[model samples]
Target: MSAPPATSPSLVLAHPTLAERKHTWTLTQPEWGTALTLEEYLHREEYLTTVPLAKHGGVTHWILTVASAPPDQRPILSSCETLRKRALYSTTAPPGGGGVAEGIAHGVGSVFTDPAYRGKGYASRMLTMVADELKAHQGTLMSPSATAASSAADDKRLPPVAFSFLFSDIGKKFYASRGWVPHPSSHLSFTTLPSRRSSTASSDAAAAAPPPVAAIGYHELAELCTRDESLLRDRMSRLPSSLEAHQAPSSFASTPPDASRPLTYVALAPDLDTMLWHLMREDFITTRLFGTTPSVRGAVFGHPGRRVWAVWTRTYQAAPPAISANTLYILRLVVEDESAGEEYLAEGLRAVIDLAREEAAEWGTAKVLLWNPDGEVEGLMRRSGLTFEAVEREKDSILSLMWYGDGPGENVVWVAGEKYTWC
Candidate 1:
């Protein structure tokens, strides 16, 4: 687990932790913050009505507060997404924990405080409450968006991932300015898109592994209830199906865990297995990719020599041999460490692309799109004689795609693109 923030809180609530100073900071029910049940279904819609008044437009606000003594000198104010804080934490209290899946990420919004509470540490106190909830839910992965600058040295440095927006936003500035990396939303949304081609970064040996592998495994919010009940309860804050159902991963970020129905993955030998995943991540970082994810259903390792990669065929009827029938969508691309050098990376990329190409040919799919956000990756793709077309997106991301023979129509399917919120 990550370390707790420092504030020497005199009286604050947080999840029950090993730290004695920590306590459950429930916003509603005020007393026994930890034991406090849902202020109501998701959370009190206090800010939904107020954010519009703030001129921030469509902002939602919530507060998590901890009691403090006058000696503590922390103020309490309210606003959209406002928090009323007194200190970093409170004295150890009994165990109290609960949450909902949507509340984990979707519920997060801006914060506010009262004028009287300004100078006191109440804002920090309120932040502590929201922060605690975020940790408990295990939902805080920010997709850092990349800006269109030739060099990283440009005036506006792109965040490594998207969550940086949480820190960069107006209300968050007070806390984010301290040390957090502010992210631009436009950039994050772009990188979160799926990738085009994979295999360019393969190590060759792993890429060529003889297959007939079994499915890796499938997970879902429900099935996880039986497998890891504790995680489910903690993330969603309750076991009730209504709340439990929310944690399922979205098309954009994570696939919510389900049992009878769940999102799954095909297991491959270490490097080979992760080739698709790594490639997807690579494009996500570079911001030249877009696609949806499969719903709660996934295939596990089937057998040996069976390759695992996501493709979009106009229809599911396309078999391996007839895969080339549609346009091949690349959700990920492989990348190895730099020491491997230009030659190794080139051969590795071609091998993977070739593999994808063959699979596409079987399905009757044509055209491959691959984008490298990092100039270095793009340069490598170009050096290898891969045909590509450059395109810009919303000023936050860039893309260069390779078009194969016009086998599929413009309406090709995409991997993970089916899932909406995952991105």
Candidate 2:
């Protein structure tokens, strides 16, 4: 259906008040509450609000509604949330200047519309207003209607963000039509299967020559995440120079080098705060389901000088018939020694993946998924004797993005489109 006029008097876009917030939560529970009952889901929403990233006005809830709707009636035609996320941007040195700039990217999620309002273009109108608000904050696309809807106090508290993104569950066309172009959405999936042999003998022998994988708990991630951030910054900083040689891969800098325009690379920093937010959500669900939280946050391998590590989170679907499986996702995978030969890299990568498989089995999750594996990871799947399948996800969790304002132009490459990047 065609969206209503952008400036229609019948519709308004603004931040939801506390009551409206809870109302939207209640409205969306049946669709996204998953394994939790309504009470548990409400509590879960409360729990998430306290996380490091969600606190300090880092999250915003938005709603679209008829302006004339009565206060007694919930006027939310469509609703969604945006997370202010840390992202890195670096541009090509013009003659002799180049450095990384820290910025915020909005991670959009929990998009929902009441079933009664489905296909009425309410969501489209809501997102258009949201885009206006985001771009306005960026000091661009400041429509009078969007500006009037937001308060001056809010503008002071929240800085201009660089871009906004959402993982689309309903396929690319819908969100893409609204300016969020699709990013790479392929992932490698490994289903957990029953062990073929008795565990006693296998366990004993495995202990003797266990894979190099070592479990990393919550406390250990901060330092590593900091280090990873530095690594990511360095990679993005060098991306422009690499583009000159055509050496940078699409996963890192997908845009083709256009000499006329200075290239800019943007990447979400895989920092502790973001990782913890993902884990906090997972831990909440696991605690509700199994009465315990996962102790192994991720796995690390190799010597301290040359390490390969992976961090992951658990996804639990509503009890049976949901079609979507409960899965373990590798939120971020970092390999320190890319110069290390393919065979050596593959060995280390496979060891980490093996750890993920075992963790999935232990957690009773059906699959382990990794997004956008580079050539090296693909080599391990082919040569390491591990059974796996690659899939291009067309429906759920398709990564999508929208650049705001006069920002990084058409060639802005999104690095690190990992599971952790999702809200």
Candidate 3:
């Protein structure tokens, strides 16, 4: 008779180490979407140690750890590369209050376990540990990147617990079992954005929270980016625009990369190759924020994390579209905390335009081409000598500050597999 399957907890759980390469399993990120490759893991010690500090303004690390080892040899087991985006978003004011939008919101970017180690408790343990890190410090909120299904519990003002995962993932069972719940999804929609919860508030939860800050290594950020060069480019490249759209429109619940296989996988799991793409189509991973390096980020918007309303190109298939007199379009700019400054905003508007003109001149462009703003952003743009040109879309009053831009927030696309688990 065959041996029966081991219970989930039977799997071994331990800190990942380089020595465990032979026993470790893995998941590799494919070029696009969320394609993963599972194999004998290597460099098991690279977990958080090798993480590169993203230049744009966050911590980008590939989470490859040791879930468990073999039974007889107890081979040290390593797992796949699961991308984790852990940014401790902070401001002078507290978050969700009327202050300067201070505090920390830690996103798990993505988590992937090992294939050979799956079905055990490796993922759960890693996740729990990571969550603890997020929960540390005062003024910190536990907004995990859950699948759409898992996000159903908490208030939407909190980050989406579901991430882009469809209601199908139903991962809330995991977090819920641990005391967290789904946040609202309605508030996350493009339209009907809710006013940001004030950043200043006094509560026990706030008091116990860690000082929000997933500080990135600026040195590393500089190493991984191409910011200055972008000053010469045109419109920023958009994922949906560059790659093919989904055949059957789906919700963020899908949580995988787009059907087209994203060049970058915003993986939460170990194996990037296994996660389905159609799910993560709406994910912010492929946007200017998360996936692109610093150079690309700097090239898209003069500032990193400055989510633009829209962009365009004069010709050619690449991004950083050429800036030219012939090319004209209206745009929208939404600051995360408009309350932060009235004078500063005015100053910023002027600075952005002046900088743009300087770059345009360098790009051999003349005239302001065409520019327009529908809302306050229009006024801000005009401050820079820009004016609205045409209508991209029209609708009765539009929702304001729709996204937290990177516009590309981090998210999990896949897990290495049940094999990587260690309970």
Best model number under lDDT:
2
Cα lDDT of model 3 by residue, 252-273, tens digit: 3223333432321121221111
In candidate 2 the C-alpha lDDT for residue 221 amounts to: 97
RMSD of each: 22.4, 4.7, 19.8
Over 4 Å off, model 2 = 1-7, 68-74, 93-95, 136-160, 193-208, 241-260, 319-324, 405-409
- Candidate 1: C-alpha lDDT: 0.28
Question: What lDDT, from 0 to 1, does candidate 3 have?
Answer: 0.27
Candidate 2 residue-wise lDDT, 363-387, digit = tens: 7688899887766667666787777
Query: Which window of ten consecutive residues has the lowest lDDT sum in model 1?
Result: 83-92
TM-score of each: 0.26, 0.86, 0.30
Model 2, backbone clash pairs (residues 3+ apart or across chains), number: 0
Query: What RMSD does model 1 have?
Result: 22.4
Q: How well does candidate 1 score on lDDT at residue 151?
A: 24
Give the lowest summed-lDDT range of ten residues in model 3. Answer: 414-423
TM-score of 3: 0.30
Q: Is candidate 1 or candidate 3 better by lDDT?
A: 1
